[model samples]
Target: MADGSLARMGPEHREEAWQRLGSDTFDLVVIGGGVVGAGTALDAATRGLRVALVEARDLASGTSSRSSKLFHGGLRYLEQLEFSLVREALRERELMLTKIAPHLVKPVSFLYPLTHRFWERPYTAAGLLLYDTMGGARSVPGQKHLTRAGALRMVPALKRDALIGAIRYYDAQADDARHTLTVARTAAHYGAVVRTSTQVVDFLREADRVSGVRVRDVEDGRETEVNAQAVINCTGVWTDELQRLSGSRGRFRVRASKGVHIVVPRDRIVAETGLILRTEKSVLFVIPWRNHWIVGTTDTDWNLDLAHPAATRSDIDYLLEHVNQVLATPLTHDDIEGVYAGLRPLLAGESEETSKLSREHAVARVAPGLVAIAGGKYTTYRVMAADAVDAAAVDLSGRLQPSITDRVPLLGADGYYALVNQTDQLASRYGLHPYRVRHLLDRYGSLVHDVLAMAEGRPELLRPLPAAPDYLRVEVVYAASHEGALHLEDVLTRRTRISIEYPHRGVDCAEAAARLMGEVLGWDDATIAHEVEVYQARVQAERESQDQPDDQAADASRAAAPEARPNVSEPVR
Candidate 1:
């Protein structure tokens, strides 16, 4: 298949992919569609190796989509004296900001409030200074100190006695789900067969060596054997399970750590910049999303239901309690628009706290032809990918080329800045506001033209969704036709984030969005209704789960919802 044809992940492309999966022998098979798996596929494909990336559900349906959404060096890690990890992440952050994903990732400022008067200021300033210089390339502004009055003026939402002063620093943020999807698409563009709703059932072994994978189409239950020289397991939280399934003892264990975030209206917090407050266990961030303020997150050990990590009422209360300490007008549960919980696949350590576990990733050649990678932060997925592929090179024939992914730009990255300059022209051409054009550019980057082209004959698609005005109807169509969103929840929750961005949590727009997707995927009225029903039920289950008191109750509540991909089996223990 031509590279361009492979890049489009519509229904037609997915059908072609299934055929290819059954027939073609690839150099590498990536099991997981999170950022790391996608990045690994892209890296290997660019090195002129045939690759296939498979996911059990939608891309980024795991921890990749549920992160803090920042491309930052761990400022707190410096406090832990994890200087090398901090430096590496900062370098990756700079790459995303300037060279790699200029459109998807942009600079976001944060204010670190100083509670103690004298000692806190200089102490933070020193940390900030190290943060500013460590990344090497200065794409963002350096840190600046602010007085109590200055900080209050910048963020009037803060109480008068919340802080003595503040330090403002810059970090970058992106829509995590969109970024991960783009990475997968970029991999496809480079000739990797990227397919979601495809689960790896077992390993393919020849004698004592691993050879390939036996995969099942979670959507339809059709089974296929994909021949590959090496299989890299990038299944974040499910890492150990996959290792065990292969009957290979893993070099390290991965512990699940749950992190929760809540979204509120942007107007609720009168802040010009994001706020970072210290907690006894971890830090809480009040981040400025496009139309909302994203406040999170609690780091706690999670031992139940890794796939559906639930956020309980106690979790919500913990966030509200801490954030309210500094806010002039305290927020209640009623003010929350949405809440989400994700599990971090921490490399388990001697420390009892999940937060203290190592953020550095580990790549192991478990057998002759299989490699497993886990325990890395979202910001450093690319680096983690390179390392995994390098480790798997031992199984491949011939001399493999060194990874050149650092120099490879993702799809839509090439002309992003040029499109930014032509936003007004694009708006005029599309009969849209310049602001809407800019928003589309940030989300789709240089591919905004392709997105707008879909609405050419269909004028109605140009209009915004009535229930979720932030996104245009064309985007829902594009998600199915180009981005490989198979189900309604994939479009609503991951593709556009209408689920967490709106108070209705995408329930109100479910039908409209489903209809838009149905147009692209050829969904009948029955399929559309079924999709809508499942999405609504999922939302209700999440709401019920959030109201529960603890993780076990929350897990039970969340498990009540019908599975979007019912055929996808749970990980084998």
Candidate 2:
């Protein structure tokens, strides 16, 4: 199992990675730790190449983490006649659900509300039938049509006027943050040296070609140069800034689209299935989260603060006003439990509207040794990663192997299905409730045993946190031990949903999370204090910013908080 096992994933073991990164040149050095970067690192490493993945923050701390959390085939893409895109996404979705990450990805059903009695049902069903046929994968049930009474049964919160009928279709869902971490850890498992909180300060050039990156470890003040034969730039929205640092004119501009989502308690709108509604700009989703519903998403262009996109009051109002139209009992500001905003990296075009620009990705050879990839959806990240690596591989003269990631399965995926069947026995063994065991199975799958191992020694790790009762203390501790959770915010916001699940927004539990993380990171009292302060300030800033009127006020309010990109923008010396 030591041939790349979970035991090796603990960041504490590689705490001094910066010291070793400069000691060698890698075959490939990935510039971002989001899904695409992590996937590229894994793909390259698994194909017998030495790789290093660096990120300024924890994995998926951006759009990868703040997604709709659905492995959907973009039902709207059907209407646009992007059948190729839909087919590709559905194939990837099937791979994720069936083979690649059976542990992390599970199917979820959504009710497509049919406003018109006769026309919409048949039309939507025809689209879904095409979707089911396109994938040629049967990991989930096919679409089915239902009458008004059946639709009401699925979504009782919807008003009688909201729909005359509905079509039920399945899409896979995942814990976005956890899945990203799993991808990175899987990359590590394949001999890729992946490190987070390591920012690429500047590019290392050899003659006219960009050779590698000069990176700084954020944990300490040390700097390291990661040399690579070819560098694949998968930095997402920061594509232009990173390429310009190499003094090469970027081929395409990446425009940022700000999408905001709100989380509310499940009781606020009791729905048997997730609801998808047609919006003016884009589609709206009311997803069923753990005891809560994730209602969101306003699509608008954002030009400022790519790191911390704020949810302005107008954005919140737009979402509420749209969603409340269908709800029998409208969800007001008081009903909201949490709010999050993320920027979609869209390819810039003649129009200023971010929603209209292509979600398709672009790859360019900025210099002799660098390939920059930008503007792609999370679901389509694998193809983008494969393409970026393939393009960069052209710079290498050797016979490189073709991409095999389509057949790759992530960690925790090997024995997942069987584990689901034995959930009762596993629960008895762990001394947890049946439902709690099922929850763990859904979250951790076969690796539930790995999670329970900590509790075997401590016994008390089985207990739940005080402020956030949904997660166990072991999960918070394990986040640091396995997942590279550097700060309290990573544990609260990403590792767990406490940041958005609890009404307090992880404020009351910040200190507790800090104390748990301190043990793993060897943090002193001052360090713990600083982590808690930064996390609290972030939550406060997000809340305050969300109350503001427009994007400008929201940006100003969010600026009051600590920045993710601390000091990379200064002219490179």
Candidate 3:
């Protein structure tokens, strides 16, 4: 509540975390700091139980951050008649929009281009009517069937012959990495011991149950024993590897499917409405990201490095060719500003294909004290966490209560709606323009006051980073001081999004950002150099990898960056 500065998780916070979790005992230990894991920790902590959350890398560094950034009920799933998944996701969307994260998540509209005139309109309209009825979808207007003229009017960027008609509908979107970070920050606010860059190397077993995890501080390389009544694994794509860490065969295996997205300047695609163009393999989306468009996602089987999934030349070309079919101006390789790839964990079935697998998650009790959850979508993470907790509570050995997170608001949600009205006052107080203050409000809600207050002594901090003009210098400092951004990549890639937003991919600003962050993290000259070197190599690898023709070539190109200390971060399952 006190500005939510991550400074609380420093040496003192670390000392306190260890005193409780480091003391070899807790009521619950939740592994992995992705959204689901963060949610599980919060659910367990808020229910009057002691909890500890451990992440081998920065929080949300996996699929949670590198997502399509939507919070909508899966519309395509509706086509598949996955009514339950859509309804559940719609309910969560309502909570995030009106109750949970009003400041972070907002409504966004998409245009479904009708390739055929008559049948496509009615068929889509019938499905949308059902979509509108699913849950608490009242905040948005119902879908509207539109004429080709109406559709073209809504999306002026489209060529004349691109569509027969269109159906415009609404969905919600969020800054995924920031939302996940807020979840962890909110968990800590509720007294959960939260630590990142801490590895869960092994499970602590008693008789037949998992009692806790033997964790190693990847930063300091110190081993510590954390005892807990129950352990829940929310490692997503890395489920099988974590199960192996326990030396137990999992109830099922998790198959990794790779999806890649490219970011381009929004001006290249002139459209009033976001476009969802159907492709032979899947749907192609030209969704609006801040000052840019996010064109993505090629789904395919991946058996390579989970930590850094590389996108090859063919994948990029496929996206360009498909998206260019309707574009008035075509986007080329040079048009791309940022590119990212993520892996989804699908429960392996008899079908060896990853795309054919379902997104429904699995909860398994491999050991008496351990429960593992994997293979769910971003919107239903709360459900996955609740289910994981429900499964592990069997071993909790107490009169337990059902999950209350359904009715509970995340930390900023309580007063977020009211704060939206006070943007002018907040702007004046921070000595920034109302629009700038509004941007911060949308990003951090009441937490903007914390970021602003941190900059009170240095008014110069209100200005933008020279290299990454989209972010303030204070944001870099805040990432280190309050948002658990211990490393340069954490600040650029996750905390601030400078890595993908900038043309140089944050390589140019590495030193300047590092110098600013040094004030908070106490980094010396050598450490700064090391961080810069590592980050530069990473950018080089990613750039070189993107030029390769195949996944294997791309992956090899991306691996030139020297590995950090072994076991510094968990290879996302």
Off by over 4 Å in 3: 1-7, 563-573
Candidate 3 per-residue lDDT, tens place, 404-464, comes to 8777666556666667798788777777788887778788887777777878889888998
Question: Best candidate per lDDT, number?
Answer: 1
Question: Mind giving the per-residue lDDT tens digits that candidate 1 earns over 1-573?
Answer: 113234789999899999999999999999999999999999999999999999999999999999999998989999999999999999999889887888899899999999997788888888889888897338888998889999999999999999999989999999999999988999999889999999999999999988899999998899999999999999999998999889988998999999999999998999999999999998999999998999999999998887789999999999999999999999999999999999999999999988899999999998899999999999999999999999999999989999888887777788888888988888888899999999998998888878888898999999999789999999999899999999999998899998899999999999999999999889899999999999999999999999999999999999999999989888756
For model 2, the stretches where C-alpha displacement exceeds 4 angstroms are 1-7, 563-573
The better-scoring model by TM-score among 1 and 3 is 1
Each model's TM-score, in the order given?
0.99, 0.96, 0.97
Clash pairs of candidate 3? 5-482, 6-482, 157-270, 209-368, 210-369, 237-573, 238-573
Find the 10 residues in a row with the least total lDDT in model 1: 1-10
Error of 1 at 478 (Å): 0.7
lDDT of 2 by residue, 1-573 (tens): 112244345665566566568987788889888898998988887778888899887789888888888888888888878788788888889889888988788888889888876677778778888988997338788887888899998889999988888888889888888888888888888778888888888888889888889998876667878888889888887887787777888889988888889999999998888989998888899988879888878888887888788899989899899999999999999988999988888899897777677777899887899989998788877888888888888777587888898888887777778887888898788888888888877777666777788677787889888788888899888888877787788889998989888879999988988898898888899989988888888989998998999899999999899844354343332
- Name the runs in model 1 displaced over 4 angstroms: 1-6
Model 3 — which ten-residue stretch has the worst lDDT? 1-10
- Top-TM-score structure, candidate number: 1
